[model samples]
Target: MIVAIIDYGSGNLRSAAKAFERAVAEADVDARIRVTADADEVAAADRIVLPGVGAFADCRRGLLGLPGMSDALASAVLEKGRPFLGICVGMQLMATVGREHGDHPGLGWIEGEVALLPAAGEGLKIPHMGWNDLRIAAPAHPVLAGLASGAHAYFVHSYAFVPADPRRVLATVDYGAPVSAVIGRDNLVGTQFHPEKSQATGLRLITNFLGWRP
Candidate 1:
């Protein structure tokens, strides 16, 4: 199996790559993982991962900046029905639109909008950093296998994806309010928290993803 971690000029690529490498090894899966910006590489990948960090518009621009990259991604993941995962800003980009730095168009893979985390009360922060418990909304979901309702996952983001349909929400975390932690439909899945940085819980998710059929 081949897993492609897209290098779109945003995100901590090294960290994500290493985590995936370790996960594949631990899971005893014979998968070749590559981090690349080449459109062909993305297109040929069996599983695709899109990781991003920084502003939504900037990340969106970086992704589209590469000629044919967008189309290649669409063909591989959307048309081909390959299992896909997006991390952080990468996950946010799957939304229909993002409100960060004004409204910007996203991949529209998921029907949602990426918006700033609403102020919970006073003393709550904007970039909801550190570890938080995951409220498993879809316990039977394969990507969330082995993860319990209150499993702690590390997060560091100010904006969150609010799905138009609540059923798309796989898991949530409580900050000032209930924040979407995981979202998925069909073969696509995304996590607001960095699974690479989430240690055991993150690795478990990664392993599950590697073995996930859809």
Candidate 2:
């Protein structure tokens, strides 16, 4: 499989590449992964992985400035139905708006907004860091296949996704309240937690994504 890791200059490019590398190593298939700024590579890839780490607005601007990269991604995933997996802030960009940089518009692939994680009672950590359990939603998605409930995964973020459609949320994790953890709609998949850092379970999720038919 050929997986193109979208590079817009704001993502954890090398780390994301390594995660796929590790996952592919465990899987039965041969995978070719690349870190490219080329839009054509994105359009031609079998699957596209979008990873981000930083403010939503800045990342959005970087992607927009990449000439045809943004449109190519949208076309590949939205119109052509190629598999898409977004990680960390990459998942946040799929939402409609984010209050992080004063209400900037997101990719709007999913109807939602990104906001600060609500404080726990009064004084709580802002960026809910460290390992947390996933509350996998029912019917059991292929991404979550073989994964047990309450599976611990690494998380490090302040802003959380607030999905407008509850049905779109695949899994959630609690810090103070339940935050959306995994999201899948047709060919698009997203994770608020860092699957790259989340050990075995996380690596398994990446493996599933790479071998996933849809």
Candidate 3:
């Protein structure tokens, strides 16, 4: 499988590529992963990975100006029916709108809004970092296939997705409230955590994603 990691200037392109490389190596899959800012490469790839680590608004602006990025990505995943996985801010950008940095619009591919995590009590960190367990809601999904409930993944974000359609929420984790962790509808998949930084379990998830049938 050819996996193209979308490079929209959000950084972490190298890390994502290395993570996929390791996962592919471990899974013994004939997967070629590339980090490219090229629109044609994204359009041609069998799988598209949108990885980001920055403000949702900023990321959206960067993507909009990425030549034929939006059209290419939409054609590859939405039109061509290929697999698409989004991580961190990349996932947030999939929402209809984000509350961060004003009420900015998103990709509108998913029915949701990106809002800051609710404050529970004093001493609670805004950016919920470190490993957290996933409350798997959809076990049949290829992304959550081998991942059992309580499977831990590294999370580092302040904003969380509140999917309009509850059925679209595949998994969630409790940092303050039950924040959406894994979200999917058809061939598209997204996560609020950093799978690349989450170690073995994360690697397993990526491997499963690569081998996912859609």
Candidate 4:
């Protein structure tokens, strides 16, 4: 399968590519993971992975700046029903709106808002960085197949995704409160944490994603 890891100048594409490479090496899935900013490649890929860094608006701008890339993404992941995986701000872009810097529009793939994490003071960090335990909502989800409730994943973001539908949240990680860690509806799945940096748990997720049909 052709798995495209989108390169829109807003993420650590090489590192993400390496992570996916490692996962493909360890797993039995025959996936050709390529990093590209080409809209044509994204639309034709069998599986698509979007990795992002920096502010929500900036990332969205970078993505939209690539002419035809947005429409290509819509066609591949939405219209064609290809499996999609979004990481960090890439996942945030899936929300209907983002409150960071200002009210900005998103892809609206998932009915939700990306807002700053509420301050529960008393030394809790704003970025919510480092490793956090994932509390699986349901182990039956294909991408989260083998993940346990306490499986740890690397996170480094201040904003959180509040999905409109509760059923869309597949897993959460406690910061000041339960934050969405994994989310999905149909063929679209996203993670708030960086699976490329999550070590074993991340690799397992990558492997699962490679084998996941939807």
Candidate 5:
């Protein structure tokens, strides 16, 4: 099996690549993981991972700046129904629009808008850094297999994706209020946290994603 992690000039590509490598090895899956910006490679990949860090508009611009990259991704994930994963800003990019630094267009794969996290209460943070517990909304979801509700996952983000349809939310985290932790629909899945940096929980999720048939 071939898994392609798209490096669109954002995020810690090396870290994500290493985590995926470790996950596949531990799972005993014979999968080749490639980090590339090439549209052709992305199109040919059986599974696609899009990892991003930094501003939403910058990430989106970086992705679309590559000639034919967006089209290739759409054809592969949307048209062909290949399993797709988005991490951090990559997840936020899946939204229809982002309100950070003014209105910006996203991939529109998921109907939502990226907005700054509201203040939960006194002593709370803006970036929402550190470990947070996950509440699995869809326990039977393939990507969430073996991951129990209330499992702790590392997170670092200021903005959150508020999906238009509540059914799209697979899991949540309480940061003064409920924050979308995981979102999925059909072949598309995303996490607001960096699964690579999430330690054991992250590794298990990665392994499950590698083996997911959808």
Candidate 6:
């Protein structure tokens, strides 16, 4: 099977590619990893991974700048039912819109809006950086299996996803307030944290995602 880690000139592509390579090796999954910008290649892949960083508006712009990337994504994931994983800003793009800097349209796959995270309390920072525990909301989800309680994932974002349907939320993290850490439905799943930087916990997620059927 071919796993495409899309390259849109935004994310830490090398790190993410290395993480997936390691996951495939450790998990013994028979899949090839390709970091690509080609939309046709993405549509032909068996699984897809979209990773991104920076402001929501900029990331969205980069993604949409590609001629057929969005259409390829829709054809592969929404219409064809291939498993998809979106990380950080890629995850934020699952929302209908993002409110950072200015309002911008997103992929709208998850029926949500990306908004600035609340202050939560006195010392909690805006860009919820560093390691944070994932409270697995959908423990029964296939990709979450074998994840221990309090699994800490690395995060670095100032905004959070607020889904129109609460049931779409798969996991959360406390950064003053409960922020959306993971969201998914059907063949799509996303994480606000940088799994490539989360060490063993992140690797475990990657392994699970590589092998996930849905």
Estimate TM-scores for all models.
0.98, 0.96, 0.96, 0.97, 0.98, 0.97
- Candidate no. 3 TM-score: 0.96
Candidate 3 error regions (>4 Å)? 120-123
Alpha-carbon local distance difference test for all models: 0.93, 0.87, 0.89, 0.92, 0.93, 0.91
79, model 6: CA deviation in Å?
A: 0.6
Supply candidate 6's per-residue lDDT for 132.
Answer: 80
Candidate 5, 1-214: lDDT as tens digits: 8999998899999999999999988989999999999999999999999999999999999999988898899999999999999999999999999999999999999999999887545468888998999999999999999999878898989899999999999999988789999998999999998899999999999999998988
RMSD of 2: 1.3
Per-candidate Cα RMSD to the true structure, in Å, reads 1.0, 1.3, 1.2, 1.0, 1.0, 1.1
Candidate 6 backbone overlaps, count = 0
Please identify which of the two predictions, 1 or 2, would achieve the higher lDDT against the true structure. Answer: 1
Tens digits of per-residue lDDT, candidate 3, 60-140, equal: 999878999989988998999898899998888889999997899999999889998874354679888888999999998
Better of 1 and 6 by TM-score: 1
- Model 4: per-residue Cα lDDT over 1-214, one tens digit each: 9999999998889889999999988886688989999999999999999999999999999999998998999899999999999999999899999999999999999999998886445368898899989999979998998889989899999998999998999999988878899999999999999999999999999999888886
lDDT of 2 at 118: 80
For candidate 2, list the clashing residue pairs, or say none: none
Residue range 1-214, candidate 1, lDDT tens digits: 9999999899999999999999988889999989999999999999999999999999999998988899999999989999999999999999999999799999999999999887535468778889999999999999999999889899999899999999999999998888899999999999999999999999999999999997
- Residue 2 CA error for candidate 1 (Å)? 0.8
Per-residue lDDT of candidate 6, residues 52-154 (tens digit): 8999999988988888998999899999999999999999998999999989999989998999888545467777788889998998888888886699899
